[model samples]
Structure formats: structure tokens, C-alpha cells
Target: MTSWVDMPLCAVDTETTSADPNTARLVTACVAAINGSEVDSRTWVANPGIEIPAEATDVHGITNEYVREHGRPHDEVVAEVVEALYVAWESGRAVVAYNASFDFTVIANHSPGFEVRGLIVDPFTIDREFDAYRKGKRTLADVCEHYGVRLDGAHSADGDALAAARLAWKMPRVYHVLALASADSLMESQANWYRERQYSYIDYLRRNNRPFDDVSVEWPVRTQKATAA
Candidate 1:
């Protein structure tokens, strides 16, 4: 199949033990059409090796007992997933994810003994690039709601993957612009944009003699101790 963005673009996603991708196991995977049609789709449930916590189960609906009883062996399925990713990456198609960093990081971390390759396309990062003025939340549901796209199923990997693909189709201008940017260029653009914003903030502080230096510079919170606490 011709890739939606390039060649058979993979809309990959997973349900894991937790939010940390490294420690999380690939509970499921889905590949869908980037152009609003459902194509080859796949889902897998793995033992994860680690016990599935109730909270995680509550989120994705995969429970420890269910996985232990019906899922494939972890290593074998993970190997297959890795191989598929490598093939897609080699084919020059982008892997789509909502917050790609987390997904990529998780996949990379979990598939340590496996081999895979692919360039990742993260809508979260892309939004930061094109919609700098966009305010409020940017979850998949939010994007779907904003774009008038229907989110049929959520939480499941297949559903989220398809939703992400549809979200891409909804924001063509942003997607096309980023698709043309090299990875380095895209990251550099984000860095420069944030750098400018930081400078503006610093200048404002300096002009007002607001003791900006005394204010901590740590992200999420200005005060390191406060953040830690």
C-alpha cells in the first residue's frame, strides 16, 4: 500500500504497564491509514513479564489475569513488533504517534534485545512547531474535538493509532509543513522558538529589576527545591 504520508506510514501505538515507555511492555500495536481509511491493522497482548498494575489495567483495560491467560509470550511478540518497525522505517515511511517521544522511548527501551528502525512523527512536537499560539490542552481527544474528527475508540492502541492518523489528516497545513522539515531543522526550529520566548521573559524581568537571576531556572517550576518538594 502507498504510504499515506510517504510509503505505508505506520500508525503505531501501545498499551503499557505505566507511562514510562522504558519499563512498559508493548501490550498492543496498530497500523492504520493516514488518509482516513482503515488499512492493515494489528493488535497484540503480551505477558509484559512485569505484573500489570490495577491502575494501568484501569486505563487500557488489559489486566494481569487476562494477559497471562491469553496474550502471546513477551519476547516473541516484541521481536515481531520490532521487525515490523524496522521494515517500515527502512521503507521511508514515518511512524505516527500522538506524543511520539513517549512512544518511541518506550518502544526503544522495551525492545532492547530486538532490532528495529523508523523515523518517528510526533503530533505533540509538530503542534509545538506550527501552532505556537495554540493554548489549552492538546490531547488526542482535544485535537479530535477541535478538528471535528470522530474518536471512535480510545485507550486501545489500535483506536489511538487511528485517531492520531486522522488527526494528521485534519491538520494538513501543519502536517505538510513539518513533513518537509528535516529532523534537525524541526528540532532546531523548536529550540529557537522557545529560546526567543525565554529571552523575552528574561528581558522583561531584567527591565523591571525583578531579580530574575534569583529566580530558579528549572523547568516546570522555577525553584529547584520547590519542584523537588
Candidate 2:
């Protein structure tokens, strides 16, 4: 079987108004396509239709004023973002993201009743499953460095999207089992990996008498805005 590293991948990254996908709005988004040696990308900036909190702006450096001046309508930008993902799926490419659950959930919520279908490649989930004992943060930058991949921009959508693809591309090269596996199968395995990790965390919380009510096991996407603790 051909390795996914040798095939095209459509990686997406979104900067939003909040951490919770349920209430967050799209502030900026990028869908980056990696076809072997070539990289092509599209980016979107949205007004979000609400204030971008100071904390959110600090993370991505995308201010409400900047978006307001440059953005299209929030709904229109979301619709086009989803359409772009659809195009990737239609073209038989896996959709990649760093923390896919968050980005994908934000897209799903912003477009109500929309079906987010595709073979999803989540580098975050893959790392968690494959490198279960490694310590320290798995933020995209950290992961990129851990895998010896360069990330020029930390929070920009295009940079992160492309970085995710690079990180994912490196994973299979590091883990031969993944190199031999198909994206569809690996995505399914990620679902199980996510669930297993959530179960372990919940058990830890229970043992330590901490609240785990908001710990979600959803992989790739969550259909609704979750009130996580």
C-alpha cells in the first residue's frame, strides 16, 4: 500500500473566539493542501459576529478590529470553509488538523446540521496514541519541534495547517506501523485511542476526587458545544 506521506493531504487549522467550540466563532481559518513536494493553501478571516476576547487575540494575534476590517460575514466564511473541506473529501484526500476535535467541532457548530465527512488525520491524536509516555506540552509548535519539523509561525492558520501536515507526514516515517496503515483505518484507531485516553483520565479523576464531568471522548469532531470543565 502507498504511504499517506506520499499522497495529498488537506490540512486545516482555525483560530477561534474561544476555547469552547460550542460558543466559539471562526476568527481565521486555513486549509492547506500538501501534495508531495508542493504545498497550496487558502486562508479566511472572519468578523466572528462577536467580540474577540483579549485572551483570544493574545493567542492568535488576530484582533476584532483587524477581522472587522478584512473579514467577510461569519456565516459566509464558515460556509466556504466547509465547502473547502468537502472539496478535499471529494478529491479522496485525508483532512488533517492539529487538535482536530476542536477545529472540526467549531466548523460543525458554525454550520448547523452540516455533515463533516472524510478520512480525518489528526496529528495531535496520533501523537497521543503513539507516544503515550512522552511528557510535556503537545501544542503544534512543541510537536513540530519534537518531530524535528520547522514551524515558522506559531498561531497563524496557514502555518499551523501546514505544520500539522508536516508533523503527520513525519509520524509514519517514525512509526512504520502507521506507514503501512491506511488513513481510514488510522482514523478509526484514533477514535479508540481518544476513548481510551479519556477513560484513563476519568479514572484518574475519580481516584483523586476531581471532577471529570466535562472530559469528552469525542474524536475528530464533537457535534455540539461541550461545557467542559
Candidate 3:
């Protein structure tokens, strides 16, 4: 099987009203195509049917008034985003996302019938597997800096989506393990990696006698707040 490094990639990202995926309302999103060269993407702004908090607006620079004036209806935007993902998946492009669970979970909650199809390559998970002990924040900006991928727009969905794809494309070059494996293999490995990390954190929480009930071990998305370990 050919490595994902040599294959076409589909990347996604969303900017929302809150940092928590379960409660966040999508303000903007982008679906991008990453070939060997660069990312080409389509972006959307949605009214989200709610106020965009000052903090959230500060992060993404998307205000409620901006969306209400220029954005599509929430449902319409979500449907189009899902359809774009379907188009990429149908073309055999593995979805590239940084901390995919957040974006996927948010979209799934917004659209009840949304289910992930095809392969997912999450840089957030894969980076940990490749360099388990690196000590720094793994936010998209941080990871982009670590990988030497230029990130021009920090919080905007379109820029983040493109940057994530660029980082994923750079991973295989730095980690031979990633370059040798197929997308299916990478996806399975990431699932185990995420599960193992969850169990380890669960153990740490138990040792400290802290709350551990809300952690979800599901990869790509967790439909609800549940743990199985």
C-alpha cells in the first residue's frame, strides 16, 4: 500500500463560539485540498443562530454581526461542509485534521446524521506517537512552528485548515514511520495511540483523586461524554 504522504489529502477545521466542541456553535469552517504543493480551500461563515461571545470573537475575529450580515444559515453551511467532505472521501483522500475529535464532534452534533467515512489523519495524535516526550503545547500554531510550516492566519478556519494540511504533509518527511505506512494503518495506529493516552490520563486522575468521568476515548469524534477503558 502507498503511504499517505504520497496521496491526496483533505483537511478540515472550524472556528466556533466556544472552545468546548459539545457546546460550541460554528462561526466559520473550511474544507481544504492538499496535494504535494499547497492547499486550496472553500470557507463558510454561518449565522449559528446565537451570539458569538466576546472571547470567541477575539480568538477568531468573527463577530455575530459579521456572520449575520454575510453568513449562510447554520444548517445550510453545515450541509455544504459535510458534502465537501463526502466529495473528498469519495475521491479517496484521507481527511487531515489537527485535534480532529473537536471539529468532527462539533459537526456531528450539529448534523445528527453525520458519520465519519474514509480515513482520518490527525496531526495532534500522530505527533504524540512520533515524539511522545516533546515538551511543549501542541496547538496548531505550536505544531506548525515545530514542523517549520508557516502559519499566517492563526485562528481563522481557512488558515488553520491549510496549516494543518501543510503540517501533515511535512510529517512523513520527518518521521519515516509515517512515510512507510498506509492510511488505514495510520488510522488504526492513531486510535490505539489516543486510547492509550486516555487510559494513562485516567490512571493519573485516579492517583490524584480528581474528576475523570468526562474524558472520551473515541477517535475523530465522541458522540457523547462516555469513557470505555
Candidate 4:
């Protein structure tokens, strides 16, 4: 049996205008392919067609003026990114991301009619499942530290994406059961894991008298609400 670490993997990450995936416009995106000892990466920068808020620019270091002057058009970047993802999917590789739901959702929002294929390996979701009792943060950098993976250039899409891929590659070694499961099985487990986590959060919110109950159980991509015609 082939170890999961040896399998071809595609890691994706994106820098956006805001934290809300539904409304955030992509500022930059990266996709990294890892197969055994070989690794390749591609990055895209787009104007986003909106103001890249000061806070967001500070985080990713991509200013609106910089993108306007050097970045590709939004639609062009989206098509290229989507095509890269599709190629990875078609090649029987797992698509990975730190917080996959956010990146996948942002891509879906931008790609519109394009369909997202392949099994998604979310290192963040997997870490939550395997280390549910561990305290403190689970940000990409935090998880990288926990897994002994080096994550440099924290907010840059290329750096983050490659780090996420390395983290996913390390997960199965930490959790033996994950290494035994097929990619499809892992994807299904992540869906269940996300739902369970959301329910726990909702319960905590309700117990604390907080009115926060709009969380979605969907994995990789949350279902978008229909707009009024």
C-alpha cells in the first residue's frame, strides 16, 4: 500500500479583500503540486476590482495600487486558477488547503459556472479532528508549528499554500489511521468532522447566551444562498 505522503497533492491558498469568503475578492492565489520529491507552484495576482482595505493589504502586502499596476484582470486570473485546480483534480491528486472551506468558497464565487472536482484534504480540518483536545490557536502558522512544519511568509499565498501541502503530508504520519484511509474516505470524514465542529461551536454559543447560529456544515464549500431575481 502506498503511504498517503507519497501521493501527488495539490495545495491551494488565497489572499483576499476580507475574511468573509462570500464577499472577499481575491487579491492573490497560489497552487502548489507535490509528488514525492518533486514540487512545483504557481501564483496569480488580480486587481480584485475593488478597494483592498488597509487591514487586508497589511496582512498580504498586496496593495490596490500595486495590483492595479501589475496584476492581471480579475476574470483572467480566476480562469487560470480554476484551470490549474481542474488539472490537478483530473490528475487524481488531492487538493489541499489550510482552511479549505474559505479558499474553495472564494474560488467558487469567482469561477461562477465552473465545477470544483477532486477530493479535498484540509490540514486544518484534519488537525482539528486528530487534536481536538489540544488548546490554543489553529491558524496555519499555529498548526505548522504543532506539526513541526516550517511556515515562512505567513500571509503570502505561495508560502502559505506550500506550507499547507507540507502539513497535509505530515498529518498521516501523526495520525496513523488517516494514512490507512483512501482519499475519498478522508474527504468524507472531513465533512463529518466539520459538521461536528460547527455543532459544538453552536452549542457553546447558545450556552453562553450568544446569538450566533448561522454556521454551515458543508465541507470545502458552503452552499450559497440564492439571490432574489
**Compared with the true structure, what per-residue lDDT tens digits does model 4 show for residues 1-229?**
5544556899899999999888898999998888777878899999899999999988989998899998999889988999999999999888889899898888888887867677788999998988999999999998999889989799999999989988888888888888887766777889899878877877777778876545666778877421111
Error of 4 at 220 (Å): 0.7
Q: Report the number of the highest-lDDT candidate.
A: 3
User: In candidate 4, how many Å is residue 54 off?
Assistant: 1.0
| Tens-digit lDDT string for candidate 1 (46-157) | 8888788888888889888888898888877777776767766676666677776566556666566533344555565556556767888878878778677777778888
Residue range 1-229, candidate 2, lDDT tens digits? 6555555788999999999887899999999877778888899999999999999999999987898799999999999999999999889888889989999889988788777576888888889998999999988888998999979788999988988988877888898788876666777898888878877887888789998777777877764322232
Q: What is the lDDT of residue 209 in candidate 1?
A: 69
Q: Number of the top candidate by TM-score?
A: 3
Q: How many backbone clashes does candidate 2 have?
A: 1
Ranking 2 against 3 by TM-score, winner: 3
RMSD of 3: 1.5
The local lDDT score (0 to 100) that residue 107 gets in candidate 3 is 91
As for lDDT, the candidate ahead, 1 or 2, is 2
TM-score of each: 0.71, 0.93, 0.94, 0.93
lDDT of 4 at 87: 96
Count of backbone clashes, every candidate in sequence: 4, 1, 0, 0
lDDT of 3 by residue, 1-229 (tens): 8777777998899999898888887899999987667667899999999899999998999988899899899989999999999999899998888999899988998887887778888989988888889999989999999999988799989888888888888888898778888878888888899878877888788788988888887787875544445
Q: What is the lDDT of residue 145 in candidate 2?
A: 88
Per-residue lDDT value at 147 in model 4: 85
Runs of candidate 4 with Cα error greater than 4 angstroms are 1-6, 224-229
Candidate models: Cα lDDT each: 0.63, 0.85, 0.87, 0.85
